[model samples]
Target: MQALLKNDVFDGNDGCQYRVVKTSSPNTGWVINLSRAHSWPVERDFGVLRSHSRVATQSTACAKLPDFAFYSEKARNRANAAYEVIKPLILNADGSENDDILDERKRNRLVLARADELDISKTTIYGYLHKWWSQGQSKYVLIPGSARNGQNQTSGTSGRGRMPGDGRYSVFQMGAEDIKRAKEFLEKRYIKKEHASLKGVHIDLIAKHYSFRDGNGDLVKRPEGEHPSIHQLRHVLKTLFTPEDVKRGKKGDKNFDRENKPMTGSSLEEAVAPGHIYELDATIFDTFLVAEANRHHIIGKPTLYLIYDRKTRLIVGFYLGLENASWTGAMLAILSLAEDKRALCEKYGHPYDPAHWPADGVFPAKFLGDRGEMASRNSDRICDGMEATISNTQSLLPITKGVVEAGFHAAHCAIKDMAPGYEPPMEAVKRRAKKYHLDAALTLEECTSLILGQIIKHNTTAMENYPLSPAQVLAGWNAIPTQLWKQELELNGCAGANYTYDYLHLQLLPRTTDDPKSKKAKVTQQGIEFENCIYKSVDDDPTVRQWMVNAGMGKSPEVHCSYDLRLVDNIIVHDSKGRTFPCTLAKDSGRFSGYSFAEVEYIIVKERRAKKLLEDKTNQAEMSRRQRAQAITTRAIAATKQAATSAARSARKADTAAERDAEKSRLRRLQTSMPPTNSESKRVGNVIALHSSDHVEGCAHQQPKIPVEDAAERPRSTIDDLLRRKAQEKTNELTHL
Candidate 1:
């Protein structure tokens, strides 16, 4: 007992100092010697503030304060007013009549002298009694009129208050008419194709109608008129209409939905333990990350995929990369959740004691996500393999899993006041009308470190409405998740849920084979080529290829290969049992060697941006080339439809100037062969009949062939007839001349 003599001073929850009168056994607790009667068992030795005040109401330090019933100061003030006004009526007898006596006094009242304690009058006390008696003595009915029907976020003045939607003064006795005109003007003048200026409404009002009217029936313009003042009207509009009302239909649908979409559906069913329901969600982090090679070279915003714990408001795992929400990012996050993060923290130079982030080996019974990546085919197979059921939330509804959504909100709030390199929220971006990439200052590694620190800080923070801090849920008291998770694992076995890194990795990735049913990869001595890159099998010997050939169902069985789309550097090779035997890469994979999938995509995206800028000017030449190709195609199409008979007819037309030259050359050859018959035979007329058989053959192509019976029926004896005909033609020509 002597040990408690000097250090017997104790601090109560109300911040009061008390002397310990007596010690007690462990179960009974200690007793405060002070008449205040504050006694309780000691909690964790985290230290508490001490105060000299006896009354808890007098304590100023929050550390010295205790968790108590939430008593409204406004309600207490009303109660005090009612008590002051009703005290005299409860005991209005003379002072000599023992009105202050407790034994002979009124019920629920300590004394009538309490009225003099506060500034109360006998007349006011009588009024309060009459009102309470009229309202059946309801405690709420006794509230002061001044404090009744109070609302927050409204226009309430200290001494005098204006009605809602009113400016400095009450603009209108009613709200409907004033609100109607204001809304109509806002919709017509502000929300338009040309986007009328917001201030135009004031100008229109001034030009169209004045505030007051004169005795001569002329409109008068005065500041003290009946109509609302310019400033007051502007205030009303500000209080009523938001920027979204004016900017609707002028922005992307997704942007609008993100900002204004209503949250629907209840949260995921409460789970029994940790990892029973893993909420998977992803979003574009509102910060720019830079490349390692160039600090100022921003890589735009990165997508952050989080595996959140629903039961514990704790983030189980996350994956950040310059890729969109796809199977690769989702799988990477899942893989991170299943593995030990000690190495991960060490790689980032973070002081990870594993006492605050106990997230590994917590296999989920079900995975919850929205329609995007959660509905993907690959995600379905991976979750199935892990014995995790997949639940897809309704489209555009992220509130179905409020824990993760709240986690994202917490993260953004933590970084809202950070330095440059963080992207502005949509409102700021809309005002500036530009992206925040140019303002980037944080490198990828630096931002990642900051994020890790935030995750740790958030997990350790003591949250309200929770049994324990997120860290302590898995850890012990004053211990975080990192330590608690390991402690739980040590005490309890695997709990029928465990997976190896290799096994989980293979299952999370998509697979394709060379089988006839599937688009299989061809196995060769060099390697298997996929995604414009080669992936060599470490065991691609002749024996393996032959085994693939002979041990197959069909004539030539194909090799099944699985690869992570985010990294083409390597792919896992699956044997007949679907077990991964080797991880391989291209033989000469110079540039692509050990490159992340996002890095490759970055290169392609950068080049495409450059190409687009260049093409705006080069498009004319490209158009011309396209036109030329199209013209040639059209001509070829027309030529293909030409008839063979028509083409031969045109080819046989050798009776032009070139045909005459060919005839002369033929005649010269005939003259040489016939010994010229004489010099006269070499003349033009004799050259014509030199080869009658040749003339007949040349004319045969131009003439139509008649049947032998028709020719025979025409005429016979042509020699003498020909001589008579020639003589007759000569005689007719002379007669006609």
Candidate 2:
């Protein structure tokens, strides 16, 4: 194995094809033969040999008996029976299996024929024959030569393997050149927005229109009809249009002028400036929800509004709560452009009277928007109102609004599909619509702010092919003015025809002892609670208070109210008193505009010393006590360590004394002497005396030492001596007799 691998015998682009055999030593009987074929011909030949011929050839002994080899009765009988059972199963010329022959009923019938008894079950016969068939018993079957032999039973085109594209449409079919040419023609003829433009019709419509007789009046083949795909159109436009065309289109509506002048012949063809066009449309937001505590229900839906902007697509205004955004809402949203300009003025401390603004101040001279009912039928009522408001700023005619009506159709086409979903719920749709409004709103305060922030981003960061954010493009325009517009601001001591600002009416708040005197509670005319609040009004006349009450500013005479309202610069209400406080303009707070929510704690964090001072003294004292406790614990730990060392030394000393005493006791016990001499002498004497006195009584060698009779006469003697004396006396009497 190692030698073959090292020689690269099996390494080839094609997989290993040749067979390798393994053997144990040189034994022929202990060999394993493995075979493989690289091609189908070789594989089929081997398969035929194994399945049909049994791979057998005649030996010399069998060759001499050729006539009898296959002619024997047993062999002929087996061949006839196999042919009868297998002839019906001969494979056809086609490469498909003979499913009918392989069916269970047919196979069962074939098996039953060979069995002599008609009653023999097909299952039993199949089992009997199948076992032998699996073991390469080919003699029990017959092989038909090739499927070609049965051509009559098969059909045309034998499924000998084939590859794709070998069939129909071999020549003269539409190819890549036709597609390329058609695309080139479309590019030259159409407008190039990602969305469909006025110039490009649906492909199906175009094809049908062109399908009519050609100039030669001959029948022409028509290509399949299709919609002009946005992808295909974009590619064609990119190839055909120059960057200048795109830049011109982006500048804005070429139809109207900033002075509300309709463009003349040349101006119609000329590019409108970037800041001249503002389109407005509304989309609903899906996720907007407002809970109604009174009804325990939610007012959840999207609302419509429009975007007001110049050609820069800077957002200038947005109107909310246009319930049923019909013609009314559309008009309202449009009208907000002037209001936005006014608000910007008041915020800048400038005269917000609409008559004072430049001709281009309010909004784009031409409005581009959807054709909702509100937008479509914008009436004299709406126009006259706008005219009256802007009459103070400029006497621009309102006819310019006509230029944007037609643009609504294009806006619908561009925006509706781009909304969140296909016919999304109104809420989501409205929100998406507001994105355009938001873009327009940014233009209201300072067009430059949006341009600097987003216009730069769109150009530098985003793909140039797509439109940049209004802010992105605006960023390149110019630095923004710091002022914002405002409206209805109360003047400082300036008397109007019927009204004037009044001194603040102070409402003393009920106080508890817990409340600090320095912290005076304040409540606005709106009944909103305020703390440490103060405001100044320009008017100090008492009649001003009566005028304010008449105008819904001061406390109601019939009903108790929290406080009386007085007007100020930007504040909705004034809170200063005339005598004790003497209303005066706040130098530091004069520019304050909107209410904002902030965390008091968060602001206090900027003053570290104040924050530390605010900490409770009790807590500080407790912390100091805890530190002292920790210090005492450190000292106690040191004392414990010293005591532990002393105890350890004392224990070691006691252990050493105990060990010494134990050793001494063991030595003393070992040194103690035994009385061996005296004990040994006594024992030896006793043993020697006992051995010499063996003839005294009942001795083996001697009869008696002291007479047995004498011993027996002494009754106090032991029983043994008495018995021995009796026996001796009897022996003596016998001798005497």
Candidate 3:
């Protein structure tokens, strides 16, 4: 037998359950009938309860309490307010209640006083107290039972009276036939990609079924009193369909699946330890930033790639850069997972203790991310290199990586007030004069520093709602991210794998050559060539240095190399033994020293285009000059043939050598006396005379004429003439014989 105590519920022999509201003594107490018909308590004798065999403890007799979570927030709030009214009479710090307050006479007075003070009837107060005691003394019991019982099931003016409209327009109540028609209209017209409005559908329905034709065959609308109003149609539609069903119909299946589907579980549910799962995601910062090198150059908004741990809600690593969300940015963010937190903070100018952000150099067991970057082949390389798993959420489904997605929003909100050039919301932007970009002031480095400060603050701040395990709670672990991470690591064993930066950089960063499919980068006298840039081997690596020397001797070997598109200044070269050697940009390739792979490629393309255009112009000019020279040469040959024919005709009668000589002299004098020809002048321009006596008449400029004797006075000139004369004499002798 269960001992009778205050608030103990038991089954009564009269087929009714009763609660011991107050215990006066061991054998006697005051009990209340739990039935809603009775509100007052009656005296009971516990001594006589042993005699009744049917009377036994019935704690389960009370109705099961409703889960407050299922009810609307407003209903729960109202229930709490009602509970506050009778809390003073029923509850106390100690278990015992005042005997005077429990007396029937005083209890009635108190209930009446509370009801009057709260502007409610005393019967309402009594009902509240009965429910509180009958249902395990919980405040949620006071929530209205009507919603749970499915009462008040009237719709569309059945209980709501007349709809809102002008008095001239009569309102109509929706009948069963009218509701059926409205549902048909919703399915056929309202639920579509076009998303027709409910009012439009209602009007169309009225025109189709609630209108009459006139004598001229024109359709006339029926009186407002004869058809249901749009409000009635809407109420019927809501009752027939759920919000999700309506959303699915209006937005279509794809959109409904993407945006309106219910979430089954949390991202943290599977994360058993600190580094069990890490979510990688990227978002463009809501503020514009300036270039690090040139502050006047607005770089636009930078993309922030964040890696968040699911278990501890700690920001494991992140990358902030001008690069858009791509494999390069994702790789940088992943690389930061193994970076020293102290160095990172100090470099960003936010000095902090190592313990404050202790989740450094910890690689997650699994990497989860959206499909954009994580779906690429480069991510596959991470899986193979680190021996870890890579998972991508369904396309267009970001809820799978909700932890990182929410982290981005929280980070943005945290820094919105401090960040300069922050973009206002769309509503506020309409009211502002200047655009967000125009207000840009922070450089990329400065913005990165601000973000680092926020990350440190997030890691150190206590998360009151964080779910801690029983063991963690017993071990006195707070909800701070850093503390939780450390405690989890100690209890569950570190889920992070150990890795060196050099190894991760070599394995994770992109590796490319002139040939996209080729793994080896060619070494030439110009240095190691990769993506159209030259890289020289570092001095520390003797093997790479020897390879560079061999390259100079025309015995270069193709070596494997990896590089980050974000920073092309240096690359990692894998040698024969699988050792990584650092290589830097050669001096000759200084133009691409500080540029990214994308920028270098862009500049190369532009230069190639400009060179191509210049080469085309040069080719056109060469073709024009060649044509002009050919024309001039052809005219000179024609002039020579005409001059030879005239001289031959004049010397036809002179057969002897002396006569031939006299004729040549006469022709030479005639040529000198005549003015320059038009073709000659146009071709060579006017000539200048060396002496005044040698000038010719009727010429723009005269050619200087030197006598044979003056020409023979020069030593080299006499030698050329003697050789010609001797050869002519021998020819004359041979002809005479």
TM-score of each: 0.44, 0.20, 0.56
RMSD of 3: 20.8
| TM-score: model 2 vs. ground truth | 0.20
CA shift at 178, candidate 2, in angstroms?
16
Give per-residue CA lDDT, model 3, range 296-398, as digits (tens).
8888889999888899989889999888899988999999888877777778887769787677777888999877998986777778788889888777777
Model 2, 1-737: lDDT tens per residue? 12221001122123222221111122111101112311211111222222222212221122222232334465556555654454434334474434343344565555566454546466545543342222222442222223114423322212222322645322222234433544554443333333445244435334543356779986453543222333434444464455545433433233223433444432122214432334455554322233333323334433445453322223344444415565445544555444545554455344444333322224333444434442332232323322221111112222333223222333334434433222333434565454332222111123222222232222122222223337645744221211111111111121111111121011211111122442233333322222223344345445334534443654532211122112222223333332332333344443332322123223435556676876788688889999999999999989977667535545756678889978866654444332224467577764422232222223332332555675678766598788999999999999998
How many angstroms is residue 81 displaced in model 3 relative to the true structure, after the best TM-score fit? 48
CA shift of 562, model 2, Å: 38
| lDDT (Cα, tens digit) per residue for candidate 1, span 441-518 | 877677777777788887776555545547655554433434434444455332325677666887888777433554
Q: Candidate 1, which segments miss by more than 4 Å at Cα?
A: 1-269, 433-436, 465-496, 513-519, 524-529, 532-534, 540-543, 547-554, 586-737
Question: Given candidate 2, what's the lDDT at residue 65?
Answer: 26
Model 3 bad stretches (over 4 Å): 1-185, 202-240, 252-264, 288-300, 349-352, 395-398, 426-428, 433-441, 513-529, 534-560, 573-590, 611-619, 632-737
